[model samples]
Target: MKQAQIICPVCEIKISTLELPQGKNAHCPRCDTQLYRGSHKPLRDNLFLALTGLLFLIPCLFFPFVTIRLFNINFSANLVSGSYALMKESSVILGFIVLFCSVLTPLIVFGTVITAHWGLTRQHFTIFKYSLLIFQRLKHWMMLDVFLLGIAIAFFKLSEYATITPKMGLACIFLTQIVTIFLLSRLSVSRYWQRWQSSEQFQFDDVQTHCHHCHLSQPESQSCVRCGFIIHKRKPNSIQKTWAFLITAAILILPANLLYISIFYSNGKRYEDTIFSGVISFVKSGMPEIAFIIFVASIAVPIAKIIGLIYILIGIQFKHVTDYTRRMKIYLFVKWIGKWSILDLYVIAITIALVDRDQILDFLPGPAAIAFAGVVILTMLAAESLDPRLIWDDSASNTPQKESLHEK
Candidate 1:
């Protein structure tokens, strides 16, 4: 049996699915977007990883994740401490964001993965189908990888003044991230959907229409039969929606940089630092690597993303086909790097958790913390809203007469 043909969501190229060798990938011929990967590990392995990750989650949530020693005073913090600290400082919204990203999101991902795998293996088709749907929606919100990077940056910043040590819970969180990633790689939703169709002997007419969200073939349907997402040839008002988000993010970037990101008080002295000043502090402190990471994630990437989106939007508006491929690559790069912009926000959360103490020393979330977070989130939305397909549309229409004649 052959796989169904579908259109690439990113590039809008019609592609005929092929039987790929194990561990191989199918790429869109026109835009070079990866369409799908062949199955590698069995379902059972993914199940084991999911279950193991769940086991790791308990320790990560309960025990202290890191210990910091400053001025002969010791402070220990767990996964939940970051949220609590933020709330204690009256930043309730930021606290909730941290709690969702660090705790609730990971828990849901592991639970959904387990449910999907177990239900499928036990032939509980309904449970498997629903579980897979929820999993797909929730996966994008999982930010354990970004949270870990934030922890690294916080450690570098704090190590200059305090002695910091990783605890068992921190180790568990690290291990859980690895296991979750492995499970996700093996649990291919498309493969499972195909298997379910075969098992139920379900059949639909051969059609070229594809679900924008699930990227699955469907026959003249309003919603995807597999994932229930609305079927659309292209995202509605993609360019306009992207421009709105970009403009909002561009405006926020000014406040996000100019206002204070964090305030530190030690021995009756207060010090405030903005995003740029924070990066400069790291440089003056002689930790160039950490400074570079902060600079790129906080300062450079956001500016670059705004410019890239503007360039792509302009190219689309003018029907310019020159360097279309490079523009597509830029779109991909912007999307991939947007998540890392949250690194500084997470660093502040972790620092507050570990550094809060009376009179001797304490750190507080400053005005820019909220503004900076807004910039990160808005830019991410903009990247998601911008349709990469628009980058190739002009080139696709302007194909030389020789190529059109050959095809005909």
Candidate 2:
């Protein structure tokens, strides 16, 4: 039996599906797309990395990531201990943020990967689906970038008190990031979906039997193959989530811009700058490139991303599918650029790491830095969790000629 043509999600082009023989790969007929071709990571390589990560996970959480040595009196704190100190001091918000970014996210990512591998070996699909969601969520909270910021700030602040340095736990934390990315890249999503499709127990009529929108024929539901519509899962939550996050971010941005993000000291004099003040300082210093980067990263890009996401989401929410192609373009742009908004976090980190001059100059990150980082990361994840196909659902109603005209 010939494998029927199916819509390609990325390209939105109908292509013939080629079924491979057992233990082989398939390709798309129209695009010549290699459906299951990914660089084969050796089994030994994966096992070695996973094992190394497991070994490091132990020390990464326990040993001190930062060591402060002041006048021969040394203090050490790791992920959990730091969080505890923050909690004891009643800095609950920072404590929770640090705990989630440094400890919980890594643990979840590593644990889910291990679980997924073990489940795959046992051929358990239920475990696979649960583990997949766990891994996806981890992508948001796994703030290697944010932790780096904290480390930089800690180093700068401790200059007067001590010579701060990273320790074994810090090294292990860094390694975990590499390990997580490596492991995830090894498992291709398209390939996994293809395998699920080929599995004998995975019958189409079993789960995806009915049309999602019309509850009619599986293929001929509310969706027209010629135009994509939600034959299932009508309200995709993209608009709702985008609007919610954008509004939340907008509110936070005000406080983040107004409150002091960091305090620097020079010759016993204090210098404090809010988010906006820092951007202005960069511009006044005759560093347009730096100024532009800080401006775009700290302010423009984030707001733009949020606003753009809202536009796309609203367009979908109201079933205003006329701009299907344009909406898709905007969606793609938002997806790609939102992550770079983390550049503000990078600035905070770099400043923390470098600015210290024996009380002549010192740097300390503030509440606003944390809040801004949260906004950037939260919005980014919200963007990721949103399904882009939701935008195309309404496209199914339009004829090909109409779609072509709209595209033009």
Candidate 3:
């Protein structure tokens, strides 16, 4: 008996009739809509990315991303030094921000990424489960973009006072992050799970619908106008978690500001540089550029990150969006802004390197910097951890689809 074939309503492509698997995908050859379905994605690519990312993570941690040279005096700064300097400067809020992004978050993220990849590659079920959990938890904490921005800001600021030199460690970190990104791009758990199910034809009874460009949804018959892609009714916890983290960050911001951030000791006088003071100091110093950087990194970025997270979360929380395009724009903006908090660390690093040795002009860090750094890193992690599809959930129903014209 010849199998029945269904024609795609929009693309008019002929699809051979087969047992349509739940959570699987089939595409229209012409327009690439979900005409029939199979699995999420292939596991091999995701596994490869996780493994490669892990391998590169080690050097990313151990190496110093930047170096400073001043008046024939040279010193190396690491995560510890950066944090400590902020504490000495009495801007411990800023100090903490530096510490988390540069040190703690990176360490946790690298470890988690590696474990997740290794578990999948070896097919160690127990390890894979644990890795999935770890990936979920630490995914948001890794802040590569922030680290890079810190490096850039530090380079520019330090150059004005001392000759800033990029170190081998910095080079290694840059390369490793590039490799890690490539790896992350390849790894997707949903795809792997789907592939496994396909091989076994497992009857999981999970009715999952996905759209490559549009967010995943319940089998709908419309293409999204924003991305011109089909939509999904459901999406990953990316949006919810993003919103939760953003709220948490917003709540913490009050304490971060209220508490001591960092203390700056210069010329036998001690002054605390709060979020506001940091901005004032730079503006007063006639370094408008540096002041602006500080304002964005320490002030503007954190708040923006929170707001963006909230927008994404809310949209996803109540799927079927009208602002799909706008939400996407906000997510990208949040992603870019999250790194600005690294400014505090670079400034502190420069302060430590420049003002420490001179007997008449000594500088020290404080406590608040540490906490602030934590806020920045954690918030960034929250952003990275979120999935991007929540923005499209609102408009899934009426959105145009390639398959709506013909029904099975």
Candidate 4:
């Protein structure tokens, strides 16, 4: 069976998304933008994978995750312990962020995906329609992978001062993270959307109105039947909203780097670490790899995201815009890498969770931690708010090439 899509999501060019070689993907012949991936697996496999990931998350939440023994005082912590500790210390917002990003968010992503695939298998199109939309938007919020990486970083940082042992919950979390990633790879919106599309016969005005959620074309001024999103040629006020978020993040990022990021009281003496000092310490201790990662995520990513966004915005608005492909690539990269900046917060949360606070030593999130977290969140929001399609729209230098399937 040959399934087809009406228009290219990136360039908004009217094209056919059919007849790709197995194991290869269909890229837009004009701009080299990938349209959809070819999948040999059935929708049932996706359903099972989503269900398996959800099953693993159960043990990951409650079972003992790590045990740390410092000075003969043994303390155990689970996945939720970080949130509890933060809440007890009066960081209500940070507490909720950790708990929701680690647990509730993943649950929503996995549960919605399971429902969507299940609905597809049972021919209950209505169920999958809305469920799929929910999964698409919230899928990136599943920071379970980043949280697990935090555990590894915490283990390395604490191993010198304490005896750290991985427990059953760690294994469950690893499996859940891997399974969730695989499930996402297979759950292609365009592939599923093609199945729901009744006919390949193109309708007038359909090619002009493209739905970002479903990646399908429909008439103007109407709701997308598959996803129920109100059709807009481009996201409404994308540039203005994105600029507001970017400006706020840019302003906060300076203080976030300059101020102490983490603070602890050891034997009644205060020790504070700034972002640069922490990176320098890591390098001084011969863990340059970890140092580099922190520097990139904490420092480089935010700056790059802001610059990339600014360049794209300026490129689109200029009278003579060139290198549309380059602009689109930048946009995609910025959007994809924005979430990794939260890794720093995860490290702090898990590190604090591992050490039980006492008279001898107490850990607290420094004022800078909140500022840095704001930058991460605001950059993510900024990326999501901008419509990449705007880079190609209304550009005189570039025109849509003839319709063809260029396999990649």
Top lDDT model:
4
* TM values, all candidates: 0.89, 0.68, 0.60, 0.93
Stretches > 4 Å off in candidate 3: 1-72, 83-100, 103-118, 160-163, 194-200, 203-262, 266-290, 308-336, 349-355, 358-361, 365-408
lDDT of every predicted structure (CA atoms): 0.79, 0.59, 0.57, 0.80
For candidate 2, the per-residue lDDT at 119 reads 62
Per residue, candidate 4 scores C-alpha lDDT tens digits across 1-408 of 255446677677777555667788777776677676766677678778888988999887788789988878888888898888888874878788888889898888888877887777788877878888888888878898888878877787777778988899999999999998898877887667667664354445334566777776666557876567788777899999999999999999998999998887777778899988989988998899889988998899999999999888888778336788888889889988888888888888887787656657767788898899899999889989998788887666335434768876
Model 2: how far is 373 from its true place, Å? Answer: 5.2
Question: How accurate locally is residue 143 in candidate 4, as Cα lDDT from 0 to 100?
Answer: 90
Candidate 2 has its poorest 10 consecutive residues by lDDT at 399-408
Off by over 4 Å in 1: 1-4, 118-127, 198-206, 225-228, 397-408
Candidate 1 residue lDDT tens string, 133-242: 78876776778888888988888888878999899988988998898788776677776776556412436545546665445755677787766667766678999999
List model 2 lDDT by residue over 1-408, tens digit each: 134434433323443334444444444332232344435444445546667767876786678777766546566766576555445443566556656766777777777666766766677876755665577556545666555554654454345556877788888877776786786656554334334343232223312222221112223345523113345443366556666777787788777777888777777888888878877776776656656666776788878887888787788678994877677777777766776666555444434434434576565667787778667866786677566657766676422111110000
* Clashing pairs counted in every model: 0, 6, 71, 0
lDDT of 2: 0.59
Provide the lDDT at 33 for model 4: 74
Of candidates 4 and 2, the better by TM-score: 4
